[model samples]
Target: MHIDQAILDKVNPWLEATFDNETHRAIEQMMTTSPKELEESFYKNLEFGTGGMRGIMGVGTNRINKYTLGKSTQGVSDYMKKAFPGKHLSVAIAFDCRHNSKSLARVVADVFSANGIQVYLFSDLRPTPELSFAVRHLKCQAGIVLTASHNPPEYNGYKVYWEDGGQLVPPQDKEIIDVIEALDYSEIKFTANESLIKYIDKEVDAAFIESTVKHASFNTPQADKDDMSIVFTSLHGTSITVLPDTLKKAGYNNVHIVPEQAVPDGDFPTVKSPNPEEPEALTMALSLADKLNADIVVGTDPDADRLGVAVRDNNNRMVLLNGNQTMVLMTHFLLEKWRKAGKLNGKQFIGSTIVSTPMLMELATAYGVQCKLGLTGFKWIAKMIKDFPELQFIGGGEESFGYMVGDHVRDKDAVAATLLICEVAAQAKASGSSVYQELEKLYVDYGFYKEALLSLTKKGIEGAQEIKQMMIDQRVNPIREIDGNRVVMVEDYQSSTAKNLLTGEVENLDIPKSDVLIYYTEDGAKIAARPSGTEPKIKFYVSVNAAIDSIDDIPSAEKQLDEKVKAIIRDLNIN
Candidate 1:
């Protein structure tokens, strides 16, 4: 394959720069031996996306490397100097157990310190949520965490956080990107200010755990907590740093840590992928739960922002609960607790994404609380807390296995979320009901909603074009019917408009524009299509619900809903 001239133009600069000799040699070697790799590496500059600026580690403008991160940090420093305007600016830096995460974090610290910014660097690896807490706790202007979340080992990311302890949003994010792109690589400040850099460990860790225990631990009796058994695995990521401790402090004593998967390893040797959402990643934990007769099983992704859970069903079978199920269970428990305390005033609210199950809305309405929906990231949910200061933010989560309990930690915190879910399980177990039974009760109260995710990965330039075309094709010719349900409306986030297909009216959607489309059927079914901002893939979110007259109707109702989803998938031709 021939390398495009535009790509080559982006590549040639790194070869003749203040770039180190080793990087120079690698670039030249790629040029001679691997043209495809060379072109891919230099095709574009890394920019902020759904998960912030992330790419494979290598020597190029498009990759995550010392020079790229240094340049970005230098840009952040410049922006902070202007945004804060002469105040003593500081940033907290944290990393996960990913390969080279520590070194990359140190490199980031060096650039910030070199720019005369005060830096509080973690003494060792820590989860991403703790960094969010640290950002607020330290009263710093910004924070950075070196984590790719649950992505493969070949991937790593640099996610930036604002003073609110959430990822950068709107004007700030756009401005930061403008500043970074406008600067040259040589402008990066790499020399460290040793006096300005301080390493922190136990102080923040203690505060984070304490805060989690306080907020996540409902009043589950000590006897029930002690009797409830839990099997947990960190999935070779950073949760081992805090989850076990948080669970222990929250009164859960019968906790079994999966031995083989407990250590922090970036390679993730024990599983095919480190994502807790995927069932295979929790194989060892599930087995341990079976052996120990654990009441609930939990596993966390790398950096610990997302968690996967398992519980006993009505038939006493250990079934894994999807993200939507977990969201419903947790949100119900939270709202019910607040109501018992007489805290469900009108000003309180819970948050979720458009892709999540609509049952959250049911629960919110039942509690007389607002259910605010955002596009597909926890950062937006975090933004809601800042956007409306008067409203009490109880809890928020998405279908991606990430959740935020209260507003103490602004980001999706699996650490705290784990404890909250365990509280739900333990309390239910104590009440002579299992998590699955409680869910059936919710289905009986609210409507039964089941959600599914279908992702199609397309790599390289050809793949990118195909993914783009898929969205374009849908816009040109939309689906009108699925499983006998007529399409009533189509919401296009890219244009911030919703078209009523039945009434032939177009209304505006009040949210930020993104390349997402959702079709609402005349019935209660909803399906959405969107391309992944971080990965080279497109995702389709499908939600189908059924009516169960009673708990006994659950088995047949579930089968009917599954068939409906299958027919919808067949109609979409998503394969």
Candidate 2:
């Protein structure tokens, strides 16, 4: 196949510019021997997505490499200087266990240092959320973490955080992109000011762990903790740096770490994907739990921001709880803690996403604590905290296995979330209830909600267009019904509007605009369609629920909800 001239136009500069000889040869090799890859590599420049700029690490402008990330850092540096003038600009830098993450982080630090900004670079790998904490803790102007979260081994990423310790949001993200677009590759500052670069690890780690323990630990007695065995696996990521130590400090005795997956490795050799959302990722942890007859099993993604939990059910079988289930569980436990202490005075609120189980709102309502909904990513939840200064942020989570316990870290934090979940399990067991049983009780009280996610992976160039067309098709020809249930309303987040199918009335949606759509069924079923911001796929979220009579009726109710989700998916005809 011939390489498109448009693609060649984007590629030629790498060969002729001030780039090194190695870069030129790599581009030349791709042009001659790998036309398809060359096309995908040079089709367009990588831009900030839902999480931030993330892609497979390689040589092209579209890839995550020294030059590409350097350019992004340059843009951020420029934007930071403009955003905060006459102040000494500084940034905190951290990286996960991804290949070349350490080096990539150094490059980012160099760019910021060369721009006369102070750089506080971690000497070793750290979880993504700690980077958020370090930003605010160290009093830096901004922060950057080099990680792709749960993406496969080939991927690495650059996530920017503002001074508030949250991921970069609207105006700043757009402004930085605009600055990056107008720059040439040669304009990236590659020189480092050694005097301005400081290597920090132990002090910040201590502060972060201390804060995490104080916020996440609710005084579950050491004897109560000792009564249960807990198993944890980091999935070959950065959580190993803090989770075990924090748990130990919090007085948990019987914690076992998956031997093979405990150490941080960029290859993520044990699992097919490092994502904790996938059940297969926790297989080793579950096996270890069974061997030890552990009460709970938990595993974190590569970046340690998202976590998956497994708890023993009424039948003594270990079961994996979906993201929604975990979210509701954690939120309920936190709310209960607050209620017992008389902290839920209606001035505190928790956060959930549009695709999360609606049971979170119900649980919040039971305590009279407000629950705010945001778009997909945790960045918006962070924005909610900043948006509502009058209200206190108790906790927030999404359907993708990410949760933040309080306003400390500002993003989805597994370091603290790990402790929070373990505490919930410990406390429940102390009360003769299990996490699984408490979940059923929540269903009994607030209603039973079941959720499933379908991700259709579309590869390279054509896949991008296909995903785009899929969302377009969803809007142009909206879902009207599913398995005899009538569609009562259609929500188009891209247009920031909701149309009532029954009354034909359109009302504006009060959220940031994005390329997403949701259909509400008459029976209260909701299905949302959204394209993956950082990956090459479109995702469909299915949620169905019904009131349960008692805890024993959970199995039957969930079976019905499962079939309802399947029928809805089938009626939508989404493959």
Candidate 3:
């Protein structure tokens, strides 16, 4: 056997003493027959990081399975008990359309119920954001959603949320990690009190969808009903359960679903990855749009939180909008609608991650609203809402596809995004324009901001070391220039300092410390680098902008700006 002695010492006892007969047999077989696989699987226990637990679904300590799920639930239950003793501790649970997701939800519910915690589990698959909403709506102490988001079919995940209907932050995250580490497999109790495990379905769904629609900018969809033709793809995930109905209820009559990708299938047989952020995931829907000459193409990931869109540019070529472009359009559309309706209350606020395009702040300033800087996640944006009740959180988003409009849900919601995107398209069409036209208008009003993302995936133990080394190298030897543009400022998020290269003066960043480095050029180009929290990858986000005076200059300006961005990327030597 090629098993490492240290790994065997840890896993052998776990199989013999801590697990059941089926798990024990599985481990024994791997140890004897697939020792290399066993060694890799059991070399180290899965680390529950800030992003919660995510891994391939299988029978191993390193993979996501019944034992790991139970242990995580038990640990969370213990923390809830300690934090809110004598209170009726409750949690809302939702699952995506992943393999064994429902079964894993049952296991999680059983653990919580056995621990005397109240569990409000959805009877069918639901989007992840609704779980965040349900936590606070039900006044639960914490929440869990079983989803891998946009991961491949072989993967599953568990996301932990707090009472505020957001992912755990700071002390609570560390506290939960401590409790989870303290639990041995022996401490997990899977026996369930079925009476305490409640099944929630239509009631919650109706309420959530109603609240989501209320976030829409259009009060009456009849005004531009004929102007929009939207093609939506759920990518065989949870959105098909409710998103189609939500759009209909929002008064969008001409909505079509990509037939093959509309069903809830764990295999996700259509796309390589269920992530809508990738253009390939929207291939079928975009093709249909081109054939029908539709107005727009919209897609959601498996868990239905993030959204991606496609539209025709002035050249009549169908193109996908990047995350930053999408956010810019959504923000401009929402605020414009509000202003027209005279709904721009004095205390309205919006938010985006620090790494996101600064153009959001500029656009918000034009509207006389505040654009607060959130740390990397939506949780921080949610935290902003909780901290400042006086300021209404109008919308917030990251450079990634995830976006949240209104605060009914603490997490990003594709249901709301899809409905609003359709409405935005309809409204633009009513004004004798397309969504592409509206985007050009936004660029004319604000500036033309072009952004691109490069993600490099590294796997296994050695892969992690390499990613860490890359970060260290960048920190030690920061870039001084890119594409003939002088690097004027360097923001080291790990140190929480922004250094002005010209002045050699460092100012502390007001956000929390993270392992990110951002480089700003003299000509208004911003580049940010950070490691992914949930996956073995590091991502570089490049944003550049040019001022546009009119819509006619969009094509040539876009071409020139794109060249600058590409040159910057090439100069940085980012793979």
Candidate 4:
């Protein structure tokens, strides 16, 4: 095997005395026996993206381990100190049910404490949203959670949040990355300051659940809850910690949990992948729901920040709702309730990603509320909330099964979403309908919107280059038409430009610069292409909609939209 000298130079540092003996032994074994693995692991340092660092767990610069985490923590600590000089600096830390998560949380706490930053660390595994809440509730400057979210078992990650309870954005994200890049392993403070590190659990948990319950809109009578049967699965993650209790507190009684996945296991033994977005992840929950004849089934990812749902359709069969469908249901429900409660003023607004269906904008307009569009990621949604402090942020969601209710927790929160969705089910039952019926009614009132996401994974170092090249090709030779429909407008978020091919006019887009391209067809079809910031994959989001004249027209309208999406995909030659 041929090894690049630059890779070898990067690997030599792991053998130094500064690294632990276990790290040294792993590096030595890889160097002698696995040249290919060694090259992949040492070719470059794991980057701290807009959120934070994530990678496979191993002993290499490219892997996520103690040294890498230490450097990241030290750098965040340094930035916090410099940013808030002469102020009491502190951070909250949380972990999920993944390998080495607890230990990594402790390591993070120790590093923060060693740097004289007060650390409020969870005593055990907790969900990601609670960490964001703790950052605000504890009056800390930043927060960190150790989990790779829905990634495979071999993967782990570190997500950073700022004082506003959102992930780092813009200048802050770039500044933190600069500090992290300047850091060396030896510069990391590893010693633990026991006095500065505080362990918190029950108190914070109680506050978070209270906030979740309080923010939930329960317009239906308590008797409605008795008729709603809900089945929930955490997918061997952290939702088991608080979801059940939250449901009970929210006046739910007929709730059944998928016992097999209730346990917080790091391996996620029951599913091929513990992502709620994938139907396979919710298989056991759906099966159990069928057995119990439940009304709704909910599954959350390992970190419990995102939620996937399966609702009983009109045919009395369990069907998985896509992220866009679920978001529409939740947003519509919230907006309706707010209007009935006389809470919908012009100052209220809702948010959704640009990749999400445009139905949310229609709903917002119907309610006399403003609709805001951000780039992908909940952090951007959270940034929207931060930017418009004068407006009431009722709720917001993305197409990837993530929704945030209220601004109590600034990230996508499954706990609150789970509770609110159950409430929706109860309200539907009371109104002589089901969740599916309500969704169809929404389509009839608005238009029928269908959305599909295709992610093509490119693995390893070579795959990274391929993904970049694919984006470049799309930009250089743009697609002017899709499925015989002329492309009306082209948006390049990276350059913050939007061009109308029909009118031959160009204008600047007032959104953050990101490497994303979107095309709007003459018939209202939309397609967006963006590479995954955290994974080695590129995603294509397609949305198509048609008017539904009545409840009977929903099925045909849905079919037409589905066919349009397929046609768009075929035109782009996207597999």
> Which 10 successive residues of model 2 have the least lDDT summed?
473-482
lDDT ranking from best candidate downward: 2, 1, 4, 3
**Of the candidates numbered 2 and 4, which has the greater lDDT value?**
2
lDDT of 3 by residue, 1-575 (tens): 46667887878776666687888888888877988777667776677553568888877778899998898899999999999988988989999999999999999999999999989999889999889878988899999999988888888999999998988887788788789888888899989999899999888888888888888647544857756778889999999988888887777778888999888999989888889889999999998898888889999999998999998877777899878878888888778776887878768888889789989988898998889986677778888888789887788888788788888888888889888778777777777787888888888888988888889999877778899999999998999999998999999988989999999999999888888999999999999998887788998889999998898888899899989988988998965
Report clashes for each candidate as comma-separated counts. Answer: 0, 0, 0, 0
Query: Per-residue lDDT tens digits of candidate 1, residues 8-45?
Result: 88888887768999999999899889999998888888
Error of 1 at 82 (Å): 0.8
Which residues of candidate 3, in runs, are more than 4 Å off? 48-50, 221-223, 341-346
Candidate lDDT scores, in order, read: 0.91, 0.92, 0.86, 0.91
What TM-score would every model get versus the actual structure? Answer: 0.99, 0.99, 0.96, 0.98
True-structure lDDT of candidate 2: 0.92
**What's the distance in Å from true for residue 253, model 2?**
1.9
Error of 3 at 539 (Å): 0.6
What local lDDT score does residue 435 receive in model 1, on the 0 to 100 scale? 93
